[model samples]
Target: MCRLFAITSKDPLSPMVAIEALDVMREGHDGSGVGLFLRDLGGPFDDMKDAPILSGIFTEKGIRRLDGFMMEIGFMTKYKLSIKIPKTPPPGVPKRDIYLIRAYEYPEEWEDLTSDEKYSRLMNMRLELRKMGEEKKDMIVFSFWPDVIMIKEIGDPLSVARHLGLDRKDLMARVVMAQGRQNTNYAINLYACHPFFLEGFSTMTNGENTAFIPIKEYLISRDFHGYTGYQSDSEIFTHILHYTLTKLGLDIQTYKHIITPLQDKSIEAHPNGNFLKHLKHSCRRLIIDGPNCVIGSLPDHSLFMVQDRKKLRPGVVGGRPGMFAFSSEVCGLDAVIPDRDKSKDFQPMHLDTAIVGPDRQEVSICRQTEPLPLLR
Candidate 1:
């Protein structure tokens, strides 16, 4: 069972909506309500021989191509409301912290592509990073932003566990020890991609007609047998998440959005059958600056194969300005900046600084004279 979990305040304005939406995508389901209507792609679709071309590709063909792209790949079942909050949150609570779970179903034959293609993409993505470093001297472009780069010194691993009433894990205990070695800060960025509604598949046709299996029972089925590599890296982390959530008495549901084949007249019910098109405009662009690591982990996991700045480029920069950056000098002499204005008449002195920028916008920055200790 593919799943994503998160905690958020009950406040409607809480970033939880957006975070849950992104998680639903990562779990690979259109989910219920608006999501359910969008993920279904089972009905017959209208041909696009005469449909006016929009964007770089024809709308109809674009949808068909997308369906072809992920035909048999098993993604997560629709989003599940594992835990529900009270209608009226507790007083003094600014917002409700919610935990979400999203599941994925991938075909066995296509598993290699998920892993291999991802590795290739990561290796090639270095070219784009190199170009950015050479051209955009003011910023950093990292694969794992909010997770590894824009980490929250206070509310992340250590703090979160404390809040959750769980004993401090050894991994986090070490991070705290490392934090004592230097200053740490946090920043947030939200990726605007739909996982449930893939361009490679049609959800309109599949709307409401889809089938989803419960993640718990699925975990014990044949599909879970003979799986490898999940033990390494964050895979087990997700498994642990499943156990944690289940122990908390969360509820799970299954639903599929099946697109009707184009041959049937019923397919016309879903006129466009281009779920991604709905997503194109519906996709909201967001930049958060708090404990939003749950969502950030999505890109980190998806593009896990991407190399780091030191490896991708000798002097490459990445992440938010202060969250992560590159320097010309080995120690990044430029990062250490003196109060240039403080000097009455002497030459300018550069300070040690790392600039983090997102979508052409500079957000937070990290600067310090002391060196950051290396973590094993």
Candidate 2:
């Protein structure tokens, strides 16, 4: 099993906090790779929250092509930041030529378009750049969005962190998710790394996804471009969250019901049991069948943790007034916030959703039997 660490705070904090937690839980993961996703960014990016920041790695030739493509498409580069990789690479890890984080200004023609339209354009552009780079093995674009930056690499979590200059960099955020991936079902493909992101939704899981194939088919059937890649079975979790919340227009709690719906007997106990029954029947493909613990963050900066119905994996949520941390184990939480209220730290039971809102006030636990809001 892999390990997942996430922290959401009222103030900007270094991802090293999450990294330190992951290091404590290092025994749980094999250290095949590490993926980091940051939101509500700070440091240099704090002032440019509105600009789209494109994060990726590129070859020398790929950099030239990227600039040409952006110029052709009317996005002017406003500012650029690149992570300096260590010259003497970590043992067994390959070095990347360029790791870039660039902020861009949209074309004047796009100034009047709705936010949704601009989002669509960015997604399309990212896909095109990814495909172009894939053909030549020249580049890999992880994300292109506002107030977000994604970094993934194949190596020991701490080693990769050091190689990327994460300790020295000013990169900081109020919300950050990091996963120490253990190669379970697939090869160590960078894209296969955890902490997958699409639009503003990001998710990372700690167990194998037995329901992957069906989930992927259903998501791809929606004709959503971002749903096409299934490099890892866990990728479906992120897409499923996006599909349920954004595409289906359902509330957050309903996301838990869709992925891990209540059993027939339990559903019948609720007032909206009939609606849920029909929902389960219609969206059966979305139901996950595995012992998985998922940690995810929404565009609003809320952080959540969900355990599969079987509760096959281990996870704990703990924190104080100004911050919350989710980890696959209690020791991981202790590493970050040791003085946090131990009485409040509780492991989520089967089919439980633990949410920490943007205010970093308290963690709310919603069980599967809880009556969900009526779908719009």
Candidate 3:
């Protein structure tokens, strides 16, 4: 029952997105979920008297919302911990505001420890953490991403390892290797603009077989190649905007200018001659602020830095902006085709956000992948 968590200042100095993500975590897992304990600390809301700040902020009732969602997704709740605290003094160093308290729930066979045994181990682990000088700190507990997948088949790691044809030690090694590959892949997605992992393959050979299967090659292709137009639907653009704004601390109002030109060009190039005519004139200009809306073409290759760690740099090598797998120049078998009928095509996917690494690399943020796949 080992868990991982993150703790950071709730101030703008610390990414607001990270704090928002805490809300998501609070609303995404159940009390028994393995990773719930990792979300044990939070705070420094804009309003000191925020509801979450006062009442059952991280209460079992509140966390249940997230837990229910997880169960809906075929994962069961196994462990969790949530704590809410008041804002600390600015000068007084805020101890670890975020504490990722993980409980390693080994299989029942690991030694059916009563509450006392569990408490003892917890105290021991805490002592060890203290020895390592991690009292109230945000630390990356372990490099290994626990394989909850094992729970799907067996009760414990030992059985899972044996089932996978590896000893416990070997299994741990494999897990680390796999996690490393996943971490690198994530870095690549962040570097590339395609941050969201939404692309899938649709097979319509038979009308009955119109289903989607996650396509890895498509992701690789997009990473190597990139997006086409200034399509708002693409998640890549959002990530680019997020990373850019976060790192540069530029005003969003000014961002509209940067994007205006691209929008204008996209409108000009639309297949339909009339911009608003195709809609049967039903669409109204809800609020048109001419010229103020577009962002011109951003070069395919560009340089940028992380928000908190500006010195940490990365380069966006290439990517398509608005289009999907439909308009790819690289068709199957290296054959160049003019166009493919979309009546039988799978929808192009977009990643939610791309996380650029310290090096100039990028990777998509799909549910973390198995590290083993990237070893090749």
Task: Report the error of model 2 at residue 228, Å.
Answer: 1.1
lDDT of 1 by residue, 115-227 (tens): 53543343233234323433533222212111111111122222222332222121110000011001111121111111111111110111110111222233334242211
Report the lDDT tens digits of candidate 2 across residue range 1-376. Answer: 8999999988888878888888999999888788999999888889988899999889999999999999988999888876777777898577789988899998999999999999988988888898998899998999999999898888888888877878655688999999997447887788898899998999999888788888888888889898866889999889989988888888678888889988899899977888899989989999998889999999999999998888989999999999999999999988888899899997998868999998889999987776675533
Please report the candidate that would top TM-score against the real structure. 2
Each model's TM-score, in the order given?
A: 0.19, 0.97, 0.18
lDDT of 3 by residue, 59-109 (tens): 233334433532443333233323233344122222223222222334344
Residue 222 displacement in candidate 1 (angstroms): 41
RMSD of each: 25.4, 1.3, 23.1
Q: Which candidate number maximizes lDDT?
A: 2
Which ranges in model 3 have alpha carbons more than 4 Å from their true place?
Answer: 1-77, 80-93, 101-266, 272-314, 318-376
Where's the lowest-lDDT run of ten residues in candidate 2? 367-376
Taken over the whole model, the C-alpha lDDT of each candidate is: 0.21, 0.88, 0.21
Name the TM-score of candidate 2. Answer: 0.97
